[model samples]
Target: KESLDVIKVLTSKVRWITLLQRLTLKQLWVARNVSRVSIAIWKEKSQAVHQYCARWIYNSSIAFNAIDNDDFRLFCEALGQFGPGWQPPSQYQLREPLLNEEKKRTKEKLKHLEEEWETDGCSVMTDACTDMKRRSIMNLCVNSRGGTCFLGSKDSSKDSHTGEYIFEYIDKCIEEAGPLKVVQVVTDNATNNVAAAKLLKMKRPNIFWSGCAAHTVDLMLEGISKLPGIAKLIDQAKCLTIFIYAHHKTLDLMRSHTQKRDIVRPGATRFATCFLTLHSLYEKKALLKNMFGSDDWHECVHSKSVKGKASYETVMNIGFWSSMTLVLKIFSPLVKVLRLADGEKIPSLGFIYGEILVAKNSIKEATYQMERNYEPIIKIIDEKMKGRLDAP
Candidate 1:
């Protein structure tokens, strides 16, 4: 109770000190010199009476920690209440007339940053997360050439998740950090994301929007897995991968014994995980072969044949490899074009237009290659396997 009373008194004293300081500073500005004897009397009688109270208040207030003795002296001088030996107060005059001038400068700086962002060809990346209470999409504006420019969010209410709501939030972000000029929005290929991308494209025809490369890869893998006879093989591969991850100690023991190699970590690549995952698996094929060769894993190996000859052959064929290679080839040129678009050394519209043409051509070339490779597989499956097998 006493502590609470002390706090109340301290708060009131701080308020009084602030008022006194402002009043003193105003008077000091008006009077350059005041009589020392008169000042001394005021200091001894009035200032001294308040000194203890001022000290108590100062110690209590957070801002008081930042105030210096010189500032206190200036406050005294401003009031025309300073004692002898005290220095004159510092000038409070500003070179700029208004606080708004500083704000204006800051706004201009922000504009410059925005311009830089636009010139580089920004990409928006979005992801959704659900907390206990709500689901939100975290949208980040990234300079395709480098760093993140801004981050914003859209929240879901009443457990309703819709693309329209996500896009509405994106539109708000665009309005806030706008000239609304961006090159592309790269997002995961969820239904909501696809809808949002389509809406953004309709609203801003100039912007280029696409699914993220990582997401595109995921879709490609899923599509490939859905091919006739491929699903079970892929599932088996996944189960084996999961089993290895789940039985870490057993995997470690195996590694320490026969192979004497390091245990493969959890989330390690499966042969059918993705292009990158496949690449990793290809690199570690010998290790994988050894791991599955053990007596306990013989059944998993035997089940691989049950997924069908066509699925295995299709996966191993040049057509699938060619298609993947073509995609990478197309992406390479597009990535370069995006980088050039974002750079400070702005290219002419004609040059940029030409680069866009090149990107389009690269995509066409990839599509052509995919069809070219796919046709042979389709013909072979039709002739040899009838409708029992499908081309991946």
Candidate 2:
């Protein structure tokens, strides 16, 4: 009625009817646009929720790669099982009740290992390393039927790394690990560590001390590197690498020729790195030949230098190649042993003795059963092997 009264002021009622039709169409268009806008907003908000969760993960110092873990996916799926309208636990709940409950569950998982500990026993492992602050820190752990479990670390920055100082820490760790449950202690074969192990053995007649097999093998590799032939090879290889890598253009040229494969193969230890680098060099023999002979190398200023000429000659030298082959044959078997001793795949303790024998046989075969060529190498291996197999 009010609309009609208002329309009475208009000369034609058709005009008001036409105006109402336009208004209805405009309202419908606005409603449709609003619906579309709401959908876009929902999608943007959905993506933002994921970003928000990721931001929390980053802020909390969680590993970004953990998002790829099956556990993480399962965790999300488990949460979804709680269904909609269920909120996550609050920060206080996570800190108090949930944390306490998680601690209980974790402890429960270790209960099964108690029987293994009482029966087969365990070995306490003390590993000393330098921190980012350059402080000397030793971490204590125990390995048994349950695998390795970390005890803790001690900062020995001030104390001298003598037998007595080390023994005290080992004694404390042994007591903490339940002395009767620990059968052996393992550490690097440093002179001080050896002295410490001796002291530990004297103090605890029931417990034996052993050297790290990996460290012993690494020392063997070190001895090999110091050999006259090996020393010369390493020095020449280092010189060649320095000449190539020290310069931008030559390094780029070398990479291009070798399809970007680096000649420097770094390993866990310096001596192992030497052998690995030798292996890399032997693999790229043809590539190195082509690189040095290329017009690109000839055009480079480094090619005219004394270092460049020496590098080229070394690559070209048949004698160098021969020595490298002989050294690799000896070192290749040892490298495999080192890897096995250092690795955790399938309990290497039982397989180590057999593997060492196999490696020695492999070395003999590598030398074509020539005793004269392999005697010196075998002597070095025997000296290192004694410390590993003969120890606890």
User: What are the TM-scores, per candidate, against the unseen true structure?
Assistant: 0.42, 0.79
**Against the unseen true structure, what C-alpha lDDT does each candidate score?**
0.53, 0.86
Question: What is the number of residue pairs that collide in model 2?
Answer: 0
Relative to the unseen true structure, what is the C-alpha lDDT of residue 223 in candidate 1, on a scale of 0 to 100? 49
Return the TM-score for candidate 2, rounded to 2 decimals: 0.79
Cand. 1 Cα-lDDT: 0.53
Per residue, candidate 1 scores C-alpha lDDT tens digits across 271-355 of 1223344334444554555545455544444325543233334334445444445434444454455446445674544564466
Question: Which candidate number has the best TM-score?
Answer: 2
lDDT value, residue 217 of candidate 2: 82
List ranges where model 1 is wrong by over 4 Å: 1-111, 117-125, 130-137, 142-147, 157-159, 179-184, 243-253, 257-392
Model 2 alpha-carbon miss at residue 173, Å:
1.4
TM-score of 1: 0.42
The alpha-carbon deviation from the true structure for residue 219 of candidate 2, after best TM-score superposition, in angstroms, is 1.4
